[model samples]
Target: MVSFTELNQQNDTITELSNVLCHLIDERSVCDLKVTCDLFFSYVDQVKEHLDLEERELYQSMLLHSDQNIRNTANKFLSGSGEIKRVFGQYLKRWSKNKELRINDHDQFVKDTREMFQLVFNRIEDEVEHLYPTVRAVQAAMPK
Candidate 1:
């Protein structure tokens, strides 16, 4: 039973974290520069929390409100989550195998990760800007 204000705050926090993580992909050392190690972990944690909440609340709400065609499109976006999970597993495997990746290899890692991040980020932005607005309208229409 989260309030709308709380949900909005969570959305804002998630967007801010995603933007920071995008920048960090270009410069991992930036995490060290401006944030405490604990804060870096917090950012990671928040991103995960945001994703979970989006799947549970926002996406569900959107699906409940959308027509079939739009719901199918949202399904396509979700299929990309499998790709994200595969890439994440690959990253873990690579890390485990090497113990530490070379600095040069980090470029390739960033390239792959950036592609995956963009897919998720774009879907999130689309849902936030378009689909969620429809959901809000649906909420407004309902008896309260």
Candidate 2:
């Protein structure tokens, strides 16, 4: 299992990357910079990777734990994870293609991008407030 510190760090990094992305978008209505597009693609990949690790190293065990509350929490997270993944996929399809972003509607793109980042931020906050405590309690109760 990964330590809570590492998990927290991953969340921080994810948040930082999203913030950078938000800034890049906010500074310019045009999404024509190669660097900006690169970072945007990279941000999506990093977020997906972090989520994969989080699910594997943290949530899976909780799903099968002896406690009902833990199982319920895990189920909720899993459901949320699916929804996030689905929405992100749709967003990518709309804005990006072949490693490039074609933002035909700049204003709408900015709005959607911010909304996506907000969703990511909300998920991280939710994990910190609910998921981590439950996982820590489960680990503490286990025979170390």
Candidate 3:
């Protein structure tokens, strides 16, 4: 099982990377934009991997938890996370190609990127403020 500290560290890293990717989208040069797009794709990949890990290690356990409330909350989180994954997956398919975003449609690209950033930011805040603490309490109450 991964420690809470480690999970939180990973979350912090993802948030930082997200901020960088959002800022990178504003670069005006075509070459810089291409580079930024590559970085953005990489960040998306990282988020996918992180979600996979959380589902496997955290959500799965919570879903099977003896406590009914814990199980229900885990189910809710999983359902909500699926929507987030879908949004990111669609964004990746739209923006991950060789087409330069800056040259393609800069305003739409910025708008979409900002929307994703806000979604992810809210998701992270929920996890940190609510889900993580609840999960920790559940874990602490578990028999060792």
The TM-score leader among the candidates is: 2
- Over 4 Å off in model 2, which ranges? none
> What TM-scores do the predictions have?
0.57, 0.93, 0.86
Give the Cα error of residue 106 in candidate 3, in Å. 0.7
lDDT values of the candidates?
Answer: 0.55, 0.87, 0.76
Tell me, what's the RMSD of every candidate?
4.7, 1.4, 2.3
* Candidate 2 residue-wise lDDT at 62: 88
Candidate 3 lDDT over 41-131, as tens digits, reads: 6667667776777787788778888889989889887887899999987886775555344336767777888899888788788888878
Query: For candidate 3, which ten residues in a row score worst on lDDT?
Result: 95-104
Residue pairs clashing in model 1 are none
lDDT of 2 by residue, 1-144 (tens): 888898888788888888888878876644778989988888888788878877888887788799999999998988888889999999999998999998888889999999999998999999999999999988888786
Ranking by lDDT: 2, 3, 1
Looking at model 2, residue 35 earns an lDDT score of 89
